[model samples]
Target: MSQQSSKPEAPKSGGWIKPAVEYGPIVLFFISYKIWGLMPATAVLVAASVAATIVGYLRAGRLPWAPIITTAIVVVFGLLTLIFHDDTFIKMKPTVVYTLFAATLWGGLLLKKPLMERLMGTSLKMDHAGWRKLEARFALFCAGMAVLNEVVWRTQTENFWVNFKFGSIFLTFLFMATQLPMIKRHMLPDPAESESKGAAGE
Candidate 1:
């Protein structure tokens, strides 16, 4: 059987496209909130999330599970918000999604699946042990995000929570960047080069 490559290349399309698609809905939601307030913004968020999901699947030929799940929750809670005429449902969406992510990642680690390895392996190329460690850290981060969202939405204003959502994206990017050194340390050496060196040494 042929072994799969540890490092897989990203799609040939522009790298910026992925981030644009991922964040487009959130940006739209933020803008809608600023202009029309929370109710209209919630509607816009649901619509934008649907559009983003459709665009993402069309580009990649597969829906990314995390965004899809979050989108679904947004739709659900969004509908509830409209039905009850209460913003609480929409505000709770982030907390729910973040908690789900934390539980899912930690559960995967316990099951020996290590979700980060599956999700990021294409770009990161870390060994199993490294994947486990990364997964654990990510789980903790997700949990922290969940707690932070809960605290903010409950104790702060709607506008503050909205800003937090936007600012948290950058925080997450920084966290991911910080892990590069660890990922580099645990990456597997190139098999072809290793074999060549061994042959040369003999």
Candidate 2:
């Protein structure tokens, strides 16, 4: 779910490394799909996804759950698609992933645990109520995405679905942009500032 790290550094020279390593395989898969076809694309995606995960592990010293889980599903569904000569399995990967994410988030809430908090707590300091609201909204959002993916793949052409898959990044960015205001509202006050104010009050 989260990439564990000993030290985090912003690359000064190879600033493009992270994005390249992350998205290169996806771009390759898309290109392969257009040139080759469904089964070839599935094969290409499985190979590229695994390569990406290896790159990530070599860079970060561990496999982050997001990519690892994604790669696993890709391998499973991709192999099924290849073996069965059916593209249906490959088309359903996003739905399966989104559903799993939604269930995990909601299930964590039911267990009185905030899974996202464990993953992102160091970066985002929010109160209990804030975290609950954020998690609930994100869970619903993922569920909606699952349904939307199913609708698109079921009703549309494969080419259209492929375009939608890439274009969905814009929608995701817009959604996150809209959450900036809410994030600001729920941001916890700096502890050092609070301590300084308390000392001054005395």
Where does model 1 exceed 4 Å of error? 1-18, 192-202
The sequence of per-residue lDDT tens digits that candidate 2 reaches over residues 120-149 is 676679877777777888899889989999
Quote the lDDT for 37 in model 1.
92
RMSD of each: 3.6, 4.7
Task: List runs of model 2 lying over 4 Å from the truth.
Answer: 1-24, 193-202
- Candidates in order, TM-scores: namely 0.87, 0.83
lDDT of 1 at 114: 95
Indicate which candidate wins on lDDT. Answer: 1
- Assess candidate 2 and give its TM-score to the true structure: 0.83
Candidate 1's residue-wise lDDT over 123-150, tens digit each?
5577999999888988888899999989
Looking at candidate 1, what is the lDDT of residue 160? 97
Worst 10 residues of 1 by lDDT: 1-10
Tell me the TM-score of model 1: 0.87
